[model samples]
Structure formats: structure tokens, C-alpha cells
Target chain A: MSVTPALDARREFESLLEPVATVAYRVAYNFTRNAEDAMDLVQDSTVAAFRSFDTFQKGSNFRAWFLRILTNRFYKSRKRGRVETTPIDEAEDVFLYRQAARAGLLGNDDDPARLVLDRFDVEAVEAALDRLPDEFRDAAVMYFLNDFSYDQIADVLGVPVGTVRSRLHRGRKILQRALWDVAKQRGLVHGDGPEGAGA
Target chain B: MGTARRAPVPKDMSCAEVFARVQEYLDRELNPDEVEAVKAHLDYCPPCARGFVFEESVFETVRLKLAASACPEDLMARLRECLEACDES
Candidate 1:
């Protein structure tokens, strides 16, 4: 049996790719918000990654390196132009904590974060994540889903570290607001007024 | 109840300043000095500490919830097949 350079490359690529395949699929799903499209994206990205496998530096971060390719494929295949910005609001930075404080839920008896988490099942939390603008959602997913550092996220998103910081800052605020609205609609928490108002 | 003696407020960092960097603190983006500054403030202020805990808990909850999604078997199979095909061509 001849072990050619091509065969060696294939084995190495497979070994590296298998571990990250699940994460790649999830990232694609977050991008497409559809299973079939996500599959296509993952497939396309995997094939592309293999063809250029030699370029991947050894002993480097394989996940971030592969995700850079996957994210590029996602951006290129898009017919719709990416939305780079969301309108900045005068919203409080820690909106949920503030809301919980005003509603008297931050006392010794009540853990506001636990209250929100207990009320929102995984599906509800994911739905709230889906409601964020694409840029914010992508940043939040990259950071929260895989524990990617801000610098790693910047490398994957192809932005400056500062941009990643701002996106996460805004993304957390937006996610909190969405969670608050969903909880209100479901009557999970009783508030004296709407989200921003004192309860 | 006896009045509790709190550590004097950190001179370099105010509550507002600590709050502003709270997200970075949670995300571990702050450098050591910045983190120490934020920690100093949180040590003295119970309200600020509670706020930080709430933010951290929310982030941890979301992380665990989102990571619970498993990649479907069919997608994994197709991905494997694509790799095999790449080897052939």
C-alpha cells in the first residue's frame, strides 16, 4: 500500500475537520437560520478547506482557521447584502440587571438571572438570539457558543478587536431587551410598566 | 445589627467606570490592571457586585443553552462523504 502525499494530507485534514464539524454546522445554521442551507454551507466550506489544506499552518488554532474559511463562504454565498450596523440607542448597558433591581427581584430571595434562565428554555433563548441583527447575532454566537476570545472572534469576523468589543457590548444589551419582551409577553415576570420604565 | 465597615472606595475606579467595563470584565477582555480596578470597586460595592453576578449568570446560561444543540446525523454523514469525495478528486 503506497502512502502518497495526497493520502497523508487527506488523513490529516480528516482528523482536524472531524472535531470541529459540529461547531461548523452550528455556526452555519446560525448564519443561514435554515438546516438545508446550513448543510450546504458546511459541505461547501469543508470541501474548500480540504482543497487548500496545505495552507493551514500546523500547531495553530484549527477551529478559528477553519471558521475563517466557513465565514468567508457564508459571506460570499449570500445574495442579500450584509447589514453591518444597528442603530445605537440610549439604552442602559445592563438593562436586565437594572430591570430586575427596579422590580424588587434582586433582593436576597430572588436571583434575577436564574429567574430569567428558568423561565426561558433553550428554545426561547435561541429564538431571542435569532431576533438580534445579523452582525450582533454572529458575534454573540461566536463568543457564547464556543468561548472564542475577543481576538479570536475578531479574526473570524475579519474585524478589529475593538469592533468585536463594541458588537458584544451592544449584542448583550439587545439580547437582554429581547428576553425581557418575550418574558413579558409570556407573563413570566410582573412589571409595573414596560421594559424601560420603573416597576 | 451593627454597622458593617466597608473597605474605602477605590480611588482610581468609580462605580460608573466599573459599570462601563462590566461587559469586558465578564468576557475576560480586560487586562490585568483593568480587571483589578473593576474588582476593587466590586469588592466595596454590593450593588455593583450583584449586577456583575447577574450579567455573568445570564451569559453562562445562554452559553450552555446554545451549546446544547447537536449537529444532525445526516449533516455529519454528508460532511464525511464530502471529505471522501475530496480525497478521490
Candidate 2:
């Protein structure tokens, strides 16, 4: 049948994408934060992937390959939506930092990350992540969600590795502050009447 | 603030140096000695320790949350149909 090659192509595409579709969709969803846009993004990327399947090297990681396409689509659409801008939370940042310090949370030997892990739940994590600016959040999300290495994230985002590092660093600080707030609200930790009024 | 506490960082490691490398250290990209330096600094430096803990926990949180998530079935179906169109075209 004339359709055999096309069917074979479709089959090949399906086989490659099926396993990672959920992840691909999730990545797109992370980018768009809207299911409909995410769906469109993934669908469009899928079509693009199929169209260019011939270029994909066999035995290469399909997740990275397809996701590179998916992310490119997202980046293209968002070029107009949000430009790279600096974070404007200096006052709030100092407040959060001092709060964590004042709460006797900073100097302790206890795992600060554990407070978030054991006390807060997934929703809180998502909320905290939602508050990050797009530049930092995308790298952070991709790093955490897909277990992408710094190098892979850099490659996918098409930026320098240093940029990925900075985003993760900044993103982690924002999330740490968010998690500290969560702990305080739950009374998981409380103020210890300040840490000698120091930094 | 950090300038005062960092006076005795062994091997000239400053608080800024230790904290700055937290992400790379956690990522295991640091050299063995660098990792030891961070661990050493974390022992006495609560701020960096706490920050490290928070960052570590962030990794754990993501792993936990992603463990339970799945793609909606209809989206998967929709994706397949989208590919089917490629077959026709």
C-alpha cells in the first residue's frame, strides 16, 4: 500500500514517543502552565519530531531529542510573552532570609531541606515553584522533573552551562525561602527571638 | 555579615566560596577535596548548612511529586491522532 511507509513512519514515531509522552507533555505543561497550551505544544512538537525523524540518530536518547524540540517550540512562542528580566525581590528576599535565620532554622544541624520534605506536601512545592520567574523556573523544573544534568539542561535550553547553574542556584534560594515560610506557617519551626541580630 | 564568620575557613575557603559551590557540590560535580571543604564548612556554618538542607530537600520533594504524576489519557490519545494525520499527509 502507498501508505505503508507513512504507517511505518507513524509506527516508529509512536513507539519512540509513547513511553515518553507523559514526560514530554509534562515538560510542555511546565512551560505553558496551561494544559491546552501544553497539549498544543506537545502535539506540534510531535509533528515536528515526526517530520524530522530522519535526522534523529538511532540509539540516541529520544527523550532529550523530542524534548529539545518541545522546548524549542515553547521558547519560540514565549519570546514575545516574557522577556528576560531581573528578579525584583530584594526586600522580600531579605525578609525571608532573616525569617529563616531568626527562626533558628539556619544554624541548626538538622536538614533544612527535610523540613520541606517531611512537613510540606507536593502542592506547596508546586506553589513555590510557580512563584519563580520563567528563566529560573524552567531550568529548575527541567532539572528536577527529568533528572537532566546541568549539561543536558544547558543543551536543551540552548544556553551556557553557567546560566543553568545560576538559575538553579537562584531558583533554589527562592524555593528555600518559600519552604521556610511553609514550615513557619505550619509551626514546624518558630522564631527563637533572633540570632544575635546578625547576618 | 558573611565577612565576619568566614575568617577561619580552612584552605582559604570563604563562606561565599562554600555556599556558591553548594549546587555543584550537591550535583557531585565538585572535586573530592571541594566536596570535603563544603562538608567541613557546613559543619560550622549553619546558614550554608540550612541552605544546603533546603536545596537537598528540594530535590527530594521533586522526586516524590514526580513519582505520582501521570499524563492524562485523552492527551495521549490526542497525540496519537495528531500523528495519524501525518500518515494521511
Candidate 3:
């Protein structure tokens, strides 16, 4: 029945930590592109977080504070990765939809967003992200995956919101191109609507 | 086609402008007038409309896919152990 303050605090910390761990791991994996490495990063950062936990203001943003540590470790240990700045024209896949519409493959009945969901899996999506440079990938993961606001992302990335916006914008274009190809290759382009895509 | 009478894109928002700011529009980063301009453009521009849909899907799918990946049990155990060690220190 002898519970120390440290043990009680540990219990409190773990309670808050458990829910966000999955997301923290996922974000770490995105950075390292290796589960083992991601685990290491998370383990190291969690230890760091615990040491500094006393300084953490109650009711402040734990997720953001912890993520900043994780990202800092990643930057320290991670090798340089490529980040693409695709030309606006090359990044867009509107031609595919336009072609689908013209061929009657996609008509009023079809929802392109729904189609995208059905076509791409987690691996395909991750591969596309891998193609992005490290900074853009981090921003995209934070904004899209973690649902961080642009300002939160900027805070984590140590940049202005404008930078986060540009990175996300560019990241989306690359993803669109990659995802469209997956959809086509999966034979989802059957143009099965009342209008014929091939016709 | 009743839509044939309409212009290809919004008179106010050019294709270039829409293309440049499409992410901002989707992110709700645009102002009221700017949002209206993008909306108007989307109505008339079929390609941009298609692009917009796919972009939306990509955004949502990334969130869903990544969020679905849970931390491995071993890592969680390790983290707990690490924190326990911190308590002892």
C-alpha cells in the first residue's frame, strides 16, 4: 500500500500516454521508414518525455510537446531523404478523371473521393509519401495523419504556417498522381458507368 | 447539356489561380470571398473538380491509414518499463 509520488505520477503519465502512443509510433515510422527504428525513436523520446514530464504544464498540448521531441530525435539521427517539389502540372491527375468522365466511366453517379478510398491501401499510400522529401513528408504526416492544425504543424516543424501550407499543398499533388496510377492499375477504371470509358 | 452554356471556369478565378490555391481552399485556409471564388471555379472546371475530389480522398485516406497503424505491443511494454525506471530514479 506504499505508493510513492513518482509511482503515482508514472501511473498518471502512462494513462495519458497510452492513447497517443499509436499515433506517435505511426509518425515515427513515417520518419524512419523502419518499424524498429521507429520503436527506438519512440522509446528514447518517451524516456526523455518522462524525465521532463515534471515541466509539462497540466492541460497543455501533450501530443504537440511529445511530438516535438520525437521529431527532434528523428532529425538528429535520420539520414537525409529526398523531398520532391513537383511542378504543379505534373502533380495533378485531373486528366484521369476527365478521361474517365469523357469515356462515361465516371458520371454523376460516381464519387471520385470514394473511388480513391477503395483503390489505395496503406502501403500504396506510404510509398507515395516515401517519395516526398523528409520535410514535406513530416508535414504531410502531421497535418493529414495526425490531424494537427497548420499552426500546430508549424510549431512542431519550427516553421511558419505558410511553410506548412506549401509543404502540404505540394505533398498532396504528388500523392494524387501516385494514387491515380494505383487506381488505374487495379482495374478500377472499368468505366462501368452508363457511359463507356473505352467507347 | 444544359451546362454547355456556362463558361469553362469561373470568370473570377482563373485555372492558374485555382490550381495554385486549391490546397488552401480544401484546407479551409481561404477567406470568404476567396472560398467563393474557388467554389465558383470548381463548379465550371471539370478537371479541377476531379482533382479536388481525389485530393480530398488522399487527405482523408492518409489520416485513416496512418491512424490505423497501432504501436506494437512490445514497444508499448518497453515504453512502460522505461517509464517505470524513471519513477525509480
| Residue pairs in clash, model 1 | none
User: lDDT (0-100) at residue A66 of candidate 3?
Assistant: 82
Better of 1 and 2 by lDDT: 1
Q: Candidate 2 lDDT, tens digit per residue, A1-199?
A: 3667768877887988988898887777667777777788889999999999999998999988888888778788873223333343422222344555566555544554454355566665565566677777888778877678988888878877777776776776665555555555566666644422221
lDDT (C-alpha) at residue A26 in model 2? 75
Worst 10 residues of 1 chain A by lDDT: A79-88
Q: How high is the CA lDDT of each candidate model?
A: 0.77, 0.68, 0.69
Ranked by TM-score, the better of candidates 1 and 2 is 1
Report the lDDT tens digits of candidate 1 across residue range A50-129: 88888999999888888888877887887232334333342476788887777766667456788767778776777777
Model 3, docking class: acceptable
Give the poorly placed runs of model 1, Cα more than 4 Å off: A1-5, A79-90, A103-112, A192-199, B1-12
Chain A of candidate 2 compared with the true chain A, TM-score: 0.73
Please give me the DockQ of candidate 1 compared with the native complex: 0.33
Predicted candidate 3 versus true structure: per-residue lDDT over A78-117, tens digit per residue: 7433444343223543444444454455545456555545
What is the lDDT, from 0 to 100, of the residue B58 in candidate 3? Answer: 49
Clashing pairs in 2: A113-B53, A113-B54
Ranking by TM-score: 1, 3, 2
lDDT of 3 by residue, B44-67 (tens): 897787767755654666678767
